[model samples]
Target: MNPLRILLLCHSFNSLSQRLFAELRAHGHTLSVELDIADSVTEEAVALFRPDLVLAPFLKRRIPPTVWQRVTCLVVHPGPPGDQGPSALDWAVWRGEPHWGVTVLQANGDFDAGPVWAHASFDMRPATKGSLYRREVTQAAWRATLAAVQRFAGGERSAPALPDDAPLVRWQPLLRQSERAIHWATESTTSVLAKLRSGDGQPGVLDTLWGQACYLGDAHPASAAAMAEFSDAEPGAMLAVREGALLRCTVDGGVWIGQARRADPPDTHPTQRSFKQVAAELFATEAAGLPQRPVPLQRSPDEWGELRYTEHGPEGARVGCLGFDFYNGAMSTARCERLRAALLQVRERPTKVLLLLGGEGFFSNGIDLNSIEAAAHRPGDSAADASWRNIQAMNDVALAVLQTTDRLTVSVLRGNAGAGGAFLALAADQVWAHGSVVLNPHYKNMGNLYGSEYWTYLLPRRLGDAGAKALMTQRLPLLAAEALKIGLLDHNDEGSRQGFEERSLERALALASSYNQSGELAAKQARREQDEAHRPLALYREQELARMHRNFYGFDPSYHVARHHFVHKQPHAWTPRHLAVHRP
Candidate 1:
């Protein structure tokens, strides 16, 4: 089939939109992205690109009928057939729907009621709306999208209409504050989680905390063991705090609130609507009084934790595994510092190898734009200051990895890694990834950011100068296998995240007991010494940070503007010509 000139319409170039853009491009379609800022802008895009089809992967507003009627447009809805509205995923999670899906519908007169092109459904996991969207919804949307696109490319004119006996595709309004109100006195742990997870990453669950009204984010059930100690407190009373989250009692059990958004930060301007911050940091005065309960190394993975340490291998040959599961793998200044401290602590252990395991969904996306944006709103803070501090702290972590002359460092990527995160992994002696893992090993996409993370020094060494330059300029996602072929990865295997992690540990243990361990360590030390003698690691760091310092403090505001646009979810005014292949 001939390639179609596909125009992507989205509110913002988010994860799903990016993935769709890349995949459709790879599948031989010419894609040009236009944010749904206004109908006028979209129409202008349509006139210029003259697209054969328009696909809306993520949009907040309706496609203007004028454009939809002129050209074929398909909306990717996060709902099964007969479901309508913007809060489809939110309603599904809140109502505890067992199954969810993605639908490809033609853009007609009605919203989400157009003829069905294709759809893919899956069993819903007990997860937040954000988590569900990233994993299952994204996968389903891609499958359904690809299928529908194939049909359209094959000259199909019309799609199947809704069956007469089909269930009513009732419209769901935006999930509001009232719909998310938490009733601690009457609600159980499950109910509280449903409410919180329903809106985990967006508007958040409207609730009262610290004698003020705010929105609550990520939550997990408190361990029954911990609840035994705080069982006597009032149902809604804040109990304990740990790992940047706060615990609050429910009638039968309890939940931990990881982050919060409030409209009343004294430091922020009154005109500013609200501020979202780590739950612990937002209410520091109240948090200081809460008891601290840290999760031990052997604890279960059921709650919010930024850092965790575990060990594999027997007796004399141990391999340490360190995991940092920061939200969306976006490390803020404090989080980077915390990770640095953990890395410093773990390196002292008597291990032959160390594994850096990032979060389950994302290995890392780099700096925490959300935190930086919030910090910039404070009385004395600036985005540049936050950016500088965050990059420095992240550099410290990478520096520790670079200076590790004793044990071998390995990065086991179980999920996607992008920008600085991808380069951070290159600091390791070996980088391994699971099959489904995707990597975006470039920073230019983020407003020409000259990324630090010792990436300038590490990436070139792994991929060579020309290859590195090409990779950075291409701005595409590389699967694990493709990355391994390009020498960006040491090993790539197909398996579940859990299985891959298990295999990585086993491999590490085996390497720990290998006959070449001593020789390998000596060779590694010699190579490091030679490289240092040639230029010095300090020099590399200084040179890289010098560039990054410019990215932060220099007159150019590109990096700052890009970060602000990202955090604020600002719509695009025009698509980047690089990705707009159909552009003249």
Candidate 2:
């Protein structure tokens, strides 16, 4: 097949766009990206690129009719053939649909009424819109998009019509606060969670906190302990706090609100944390007054919790699983420290083998940009200080994993991993991932961050000097299979998440049982000693931090500027030149 000149149009070069960019490029497609900040700019980009076809992977605004009429433009909608509108996933989640799909259609004047090119569906799980979009929606969209693109590449002019059984196609408007509003006085825990999660990462539920209106987000159903403790509280009353989340009573159960922000509050001070912040951090007085409902030692899927420790496999050859499921996988400075403590605790256990099971939807996306941005608004706070501390805390966790010499360690990624989180997994003796998982292992995107977490020592060791250089400069998402082929991943569980978990534990146990435990430990210690003798880990960390210090405190404010825009959700000014191949 001939390579097609394709232009990628999106509201922002988000996760979906990045994934598409990497995949299409790998398949020999000439691609360019342009942010749809305005219709005029988009038209100019279209004229400049003169693409054979324009693919709208994710777009908020309508494509200019002038271009869409002249060139075949495919819009990737998050919902099925009949599904139309901006809040496709949000509505499906709110309505509790059992199945959902992605549809690619040629752009028409009426939004989503265009002829369907191709579509793919997936079974739905109860999850935040963010989670669904990243997992099932992404995969389905890729398949449908590939089909549509192939058809275009094959000189096909027409597409198939929507099936008769397609759901009632109608106009669906953007979800507003009223649509997501929660009636705490009457809502159940499940209902409350659905509403919050339907819009988790954006436009949080409008609710009141401490007499001030705030947007509540990242809701989790209260734990068993909290349920028992607040067994009879008022439905709307806040029972207590676990971690940074606020446990508020529901009709039959309670839900935990992890973060909140003021809704269009006056922007008076530069340091007022008006953005989304940890509930406890935002309401310190209220949180301090209530007792902490700490996470339980036992693992229970019923209750919502972040970190859990469990032992798997036979009694004689047990493998300890230390799981940390941070919301959206953004480890704040405190989360890194807490996870470090948990890792240290797991090391003391008598289990012979260990696995670091990160979250289900996302293993990690590196430091929490939102939290660090909030620090910029803190009284006497600076983003530089926050970045320094957060990266160091992440380093503390990585160092703990690197320094471990007793038990054999492994990292099992069930979902996507990026930046320092990807390297943190590499700190383990072995790294394994499910076939569906995607990884972005470089830090240059975050304002050329000279990442810590011993990535300097780890990545090069896995991919060599030239490969490491390519990885940093390319900044493309790699599938688990690709990562394994490049020596970044040690094992691949080419199956379901459940299947991967079961088999990964079995493999870890087998490795522990087959290998000489004493010899493994000794060899590990010897290798560490050898590496230290040549180039100490401290030297690597110091050199990395020296570069990072300049990034934080130097004359350039690119890091801070990028972070500010990210947290604020500012529209993109321009597409990156690397992805926008049309640009010089």
Off by over 4 Å in 2: 266-273, 515-521
Candidate 1 per-residue C-alpha lDDT over 1-584 given as tens digits, one digit per residue, 9 for 90 to 100: 77999999898777788778877877788888887778887888899999999999998889999999999999999999889987999999999999989999999988888999999999998988988888788878989999999999999978966568867668998888787888888999999999899998898887778888888998878878878898689999899998889999999988888889875565864334564678988888889998999876446656446688988778778999999887777888888887888888888788999999988778888888888887787789988888888888888878888888898899989778998888888889999998667789988888788888877678788889988889988887776777888899999987654467889888999999998998999999999999888888788778988988898889998988887777665547676766655456
Local error of candidate 1 at residue 581 (angstroms): 4.6
- Over 4 Å off in model 1, which ranges? 160-170, 264-271, 302-304, 316-318, 379-381, 476-481, 494-500, 503-520, 581-584
Q: Give, for candidate 2, the lowest lDDT window spanning 10 residues.
A: 265-274
User: What is candidate 2's TM-score against the reference?
Assistant: 0.95
- CA shift at 562, candidate 1, in angstroms? 3.0
Cα displacement (angstroms), candidate 1, residue 183, comes to 0.5
Provide the global lDDT of candidate 1 against the true structure.
0.84
* TM-score of each model, in listed order: 0.91, 0.95
The best candidate in terms of TM-score: 2
